[model samples]
Target: MKKILLFLLAISSPILSISQNSTTSQIDETFKAYTGWFVDAIFYEIPFSDTFQIPWVLIVLIGGAVFFTIYFKLINFTGFLTAIQVVRGKYEDIEKHGVDNLYGEDAIVEDILKANQEDELNVAGDQTPGGDNIETIRDESADGEVSHFQALTAALSATVGLGNIAGVAVALSIGGPGATFWMIVAGLLGMASKFAECTLGVKYRDVGADGTVYGGPMYYLTKGLKEKGAGGLGKVLAVLFAIFVVGGSFGGGNMFQANQAAAQFTKLFELTGENSGLYFGIVMAALVAVVIIGGIKRIASVTEKVVPFMAGIYVLAALVILFANFSLIDDAFGLIFEGAFSGLGIAGGLIGVMIQGIRRGAFSNEAGVGSAAIAHSAVRTKYPASEGIVALLEPFVDTVVICTMTALVIIITNFNGQFMEYGVEIKEGVELTAVAFDSVIPHFSIVLTIAVILFAFSTMISWSYYGMQGWKFLFGKGKITDLVYKVLFLLFVIVGASISLGAVIDFSDAMIFAMVVPNIIGVVMLSPIVKKELTKYMNAIKKKEIAIEEGAGDLNDQL
Candidate 1:
């Protein structure tokens, strides 16, 4: 704790001095210098042809998604229904059979040894001679800070932010309606990737003696790979993943969300002052601090409620617009498909459209970026596969459902004005979306603005937790350490709101995609383990070793 405090003090001095005196242009320029170098280094694009270039990180992301989808034998399909059941707690009875039952009388002694052993070595291996014995106790009582549903919501909160509201609009503005089709395809394929990584997240997680969960690609890459005799590679990848995700937490997850939210609010309210975003950010940071200080439990509590509410409102509004423009639905679909396949004079032709869609989809749902795995790692479950199953629904909700809705609304409302023009650029993603909503209903932009703020708020809080986890991995975990990170994270919220979006957006995107590099490597190397866990889980269900509550799978029962 003392070490953490001294470290915090050392860092805070410079931050405090800068915040008190730096001009906005100076701050922006400083941010640009740092963000530009990072993005330039990590996001170098690979040319596939004269006119097309794809980021190497994106290729890794897409490749991993496709590979996992096939390698897992389409678990995204076979396990989709089962995942729904898991989130509904249909299989929660397995929690009753914890590690205590594995050993009759020496459960207490074994648990003590388990704790110590896990601390010293990797706890991810369920069958390694001493490794399997160590996690028995942690796995006994559904070992996690949040329920399956809460975990899903927390992760969803992070992914379902501006990307859905603004990113789809941006894609459509540049690539036209064709981008929507590719985005949906990416989302579907990405489900398998989400399932694979999240499964590994739970499999390799370390449950602290007090029931705190520490896990993600960092845990899986290092520990799971060590078991496979690639300890050196695993450690390197883990560190790289940790570094990238921490940057993402600051950029994409924190700054981008705040910037967009503040942009929308300022436009909606006609706020002219430059510091409006700063004040808005301070309020958001305060609210976020209140929830995040309580840790994942509080974060889960807020997101479980906020996600459903905000999503419900946005979806409801979209539904209203769709219903109002019911006649144009078919026309929207026609444009989407036509623009997707037929060259619409888009920059790089059909390929450019496809690239825009997939890129934005990746940015929106974040299936393979591995950030969601951190949130899912905290789910309470005995079988790691259960959380992985539940995670499949994230992309479905964020992209397949919500993003599709947003796209349809944009396409339907703007069908007549050459809105589907391939070469034109829309500078404000939220504005395009807002215009679509306002077209259907007068004054709907106000509601949309509020929803944006809520979305940003939920995203900020969730990412704060995600960033802090990575921060803890880098700097040892303690109250002081945690406080330092949280302060720094909240500070970014204000900085994000106050700064120009150009450099920040580019950096945030590169950082987010950079996570894909190491994350995909770990997920690919560790996929066989995920497969084994899936098979065991299925067999347990079939043999009735895992109990199921009657009617628990019913959607009505969950509600």
Candidate 2:
């Protein structure tokens, strides 16, 4: 603990000094001076004409989603019911136990089990000359840390936060209501991307000697590519992914969350003085440290309960407003559709609207960005594709459902055009959303404030696990290394709240999206493997269904 404190003090000394000496705007400007180039490079837009251009990263994200949707034959649409079933444990029997006669022989099953056992022992550094005594194949399904629902909620907590609230508001404000149309389209396509990468996360994951699971893009990019004879390239991509994920965890996941949550809490209560943010930061950091230190299983446990409650409250509120203004629903949607195609009165016309929508959707769900894979990779299931299918629901819930609700409320409330002007950029999106909600439901901003804090807390914890995995990948899984990372992460929560570093946050957002580069390349190349896994899982389900029908027939005959 002394070492941990020393580390924290060393890091915090300079940060606190800056906060005490510099104004928020000055600190922001200082950060921009150093990080502006990297931010500009990451978000650099390529122009198609004099007026229209898009970020290359967005193209990669959307393009990969399109390709995965095509390659998987639209698994996003077809697997929706199956995903629900998987989460509900309807197929738990098949996932936990082998389908009878599915592989046809014990020898084949033994070979597969032995290969996995050897890999696990190798990672744990306990493999002997002849290996330990052989175990039954049933244990293969018991390797992961969290159940399907837990994994789903854990990943959802990260992606479904401020983006669903503030981000959707921003997209609509800039691109007009038409942006909503493209956002939904992009979200639907993003489901396929989620399915593909998460499948790889499980297929190539490592199970430690302590039954702890280690997986994500870092593992798959290395192990999956090595299987395809691209070992060197795979290692390179994995390292880069690890680096980017760590930076993202610090900036976007930890700091950005704390910063936004503090901002909202202070604004709502009308708290005054410079110490308000600092006090909030300290308390928030303490709460986050408690949850994150328990690791993924603990994080999953909390998120499973928190994600649903927060999401339900926010969605329920939206539903209340929507139901109250039932007559405006049709008009709002009409604006969305017409704006999507015609780009009427919106900047950059149809293409601009599409870009704004797709960009926000991609950013909101992070479907193709690969961070979700880290969370989903911890799911307890023998079949990798089952978890992948479960992961697809993230984009559906985040972008298609929650973000849509947010956009609708903004549009419906703007009937008088008093709240906001169409096509004008809005910087304070969360405030805008709060105003829109409060216009319909009095004191709704208070509920929104609680929701924002919950969103930020959950996001920070989940991303702590993500960044930890990457930290372990680069620095080894030593106790001291783990403590160091955690201490730094907690300190970052304080720093994020105590100061304003807009450029730092932007740079982190770039780092998060930058992950899409290596991740998309790896997943696309390994998509054939995802296909094989999907086929294997589907075949098992079919066989299980047939056996159930046969048993029912036998029972009928006996009767």
Candidate 3:
């Protein structure tokens, strides 16, 4: 504890000193290089300098999703019911049955026997349990630190944050309402991509002998691809992914969060003015820094509490706007369709709207960006495919459902002319959303402010995990190594808030899109293995392969 306090003091002192003094030209020059890249990528290049035309990366994202959706024969659709049952504990008896009333020593012997037998079958069947299988994690840490729900929540904590709130707003701003159509299409198709990547995430995970579990695209790209005879390429991709994941953690995951929060504050109370944003950013950075030091458990604990509360509150607010404008709901939707296919102008074509929808949707959910793979990698499942099934729901919840609600609110609120002229301009994304929400609930900006802060906080925590995983991959997995990377992350949050490095932000965006090139290669090459893993897990569930422990076993217990 003393060490942590000292560290915090060391970090915070620099911020206070810097703020108290006049700004340095050196700081400006340094800031220019970093933030400049970020802006260029997100704003100018995504649609290739146009009315939100599709980028190559997005095409790959959508194409890969569509291919896999068909290849899996719509596993996202057909397997939903089964996935629900599994998560709901319908297969609890499939693992351990007679152990509850067994003699103590005998139970241990029986468990050994069960493990030995399963190992033989697993090897013969070519089943790659990796680190995610329930047996894999449970046997390693019989009493794990997290519950299944907690693990799900931790994963949710990461997935369900900014991507839902501000990301959707950004998509609509650039891609327009037509993008909403493609966003849903991308979300549905993305189910297959999520399933595949997560399966690999579990398949390639590495657990320490101490029961510390590690998993993500880095492991899978390095290990899974190597096993499929792409050792050299895998190494290069793994390294590149590590670099980009670290970049992503800072930009899309953390600083953008602080930047947005700062904007919200400055906009609301005029509280921050210019200096207010920087100080506000420091507070956010500190909040993130404190929890991140505690690692996954701390992040999970906080997110489990924060995500549901924030989501429920935000969704309820959207509900009020929807019902309050009950009559306009239909008309609002009609406008969405009309704008979605506004083919009379701008290329006079169907292609324009199609491009807008797909680009906006893909950007919003991050389906093919491969970011979700980082979070899903840590799930407690023996079958790699199990997590894959769960992951498919991400895009559905994020873009399909949540983004739809935000759009509806914005469209419905426009009925009373709360916004300008009923069409969006380049500069009006946040304002558009703010006007819509404040229309119904006065002082609603307070709620929106809190929601944005929570969204930024949750996103930063989750992105920290993703970036750390990548850092460990490149710099060796050690505590000191992790700490070094984290300090840099915290520093970036403050820096992001203080400057206007739109270009650096753009560069980060490009890096995120660049990640798909290597990731998709690994997924496509090893798809057959994914299929095999899926089959073994399904068969085990079907056969009810229970561990008949001759000791204290509970078949009624959850998996």
Candidate 4:
């Protein structure tokens, strides 16, 4: 294993070295060429169906959230508090109530372990009929596998990357401050979608013989639909989600992440020249190779630490910007509100702003995309519903909180110059954000550089986990299987940097939307189950219910 990894690194080193030495002009040219192709694809290559009012993915994502909101009686809103408690282990007994009966009242230590070993196949394993278990991950995760805080952070790492800093900048530029208002609105409503999908993720997750837990929209769509006597529908949706998830894992999740990171590295370090992205891509591929080679444990470990620190630093910087422009905050909010509803002539009018807000915001948090469920499914819990409650926090934090802070910085920075006037086309990313920050603090570009890099790194690690899971979903689980995916994932990191990936990214973004088509259907169809789980978990938490000696067997860590 070490030799193979070493050989791959040896071959990639020169590619990284050469690309890093490329000139800035070359990078820009490459980027433009790629962007041009993407534009063409959207206008000419894509099927006529996509020319509709809004992309179909955005519709299912937002539409599904709305449906679940009504059907589940807004559990995301009502159960928010309980979710906190559940994650805190407040409902341990209620959760333990449903464990298998193999371990009776007098079951000994050996008996308990033996019983759990039998139940292990459901804990996420190499025997999931398809998915492989790489790295021999023990289902009984070590103490630091991923705490509730770590889990949240791990998931957060994936959601709060370039999307918040770079993506928000673009949205505000194209859609106007009014778009910010709708972004928040989208974030709020997305909470419900996060809850419904995550709940089902836990309910239908497949635990493996190795004790590792594997669960996601794929598991729930197939399992939940089948339980509802819609086996055909479930199977189709599950397959569709798995296929799209794989594409998403590769394109939006992996390559895009690498592409952004390579760009950040080049800009921040002042590495100038052509094929610079390729060189950085090589470096990124190498680093990612190391982490991803370890699979989920390594990915979770790094993200748990990186996510919170990066977020804290970014948020603190934004707070400073907000404090500097305290008076203009109201005006900014006003602009967001008025622009969202009234159309500032900047966003293609009201309809355009709404679509931009929903599309960007949903992409940012990934509420209905079902990716979060993949991460949450690993949380240690007996009840499939417990983690769902905890999962609701993701969107609120990602879009509502993180994205909001970013918007404020950009909005307040434009207090005098007019945010809507600045067009979306920017030569350098660090500059767009630096321009925003330097409004208050001079030479703040350095700080923005650091923030972007950290944000990119955290995001890269988390997405690695998401992609690995998707890889396992299709390929069988095992160490060799995982290594193959990680290596390929790393190679893409290099590819993303070296070449213009407009076509690849567009296809991936489309694939991400396509995920919503099937995943939302699954969540919507079984929203009732989500409601039931919500009620059950809440009732148990409220009553502080548990058996003194009744809660049997250890719950799989996080699943």
Candidate maximizing lDDT = 2
369-389 per-residue lDDT for model 1 (tens digits): 889899999887778888899
Ranking by lDDT: 2, 1, 4, 3
Q: Summarize candidate 2's per-residue lDDT along 1-559 as a digit string, tens digits.
A: 5644564565455455556556767777766666678789889999998767999999999999999999999999999999999898877655654565222333144444556567567646745533322221123445677889999999999999999999988998889999999999989999999999999999999877655778999999999999999999999999999989988998999999999999999998999889899999999999998888888888998999999999999999999999999999999999999999998787899999999999999999999888989988887778999999999999999999999999999999998887898899999899999999999999999999999999999999999999999988987777888888998899899988878767779888988988999999999999999999999999978876776675622111111
Best by TM-score: 2
Off by over 4 Å in 4: 1-52, 88-145, 418-430, 545-559
> Which candidate model has the greater TM-score, 3 or 4?
3
Q: CA RMSD for every model?
A: 7.2, 6.0, 7.8, 7.3
Candidate 3 minimal-lDDT segment of 10 residues: 95-104
In candidate 3, what are the lDDT values of residues 427-520, reduced to their tens digit? 5356567667888988787888888788778888878988888878876777777887788898888877776544445556676777787888
Superior by lDDT: candidate 1 or candidate 4: 1
The candidates, ranked best first by TM-score, are 2, 1, 3, 4
User: Which sections of candidate 3 miss by over 4 Å?
Assistant: 1-52, 92-148, 173-176, 272-274, 342-349, 416-424, 545-554
List the candidates' TM-scores in order.
0.87, 0.90, 0.81, 0.80
TM-score of candidate 2 on Cα atoms, chains taken together: 0.90
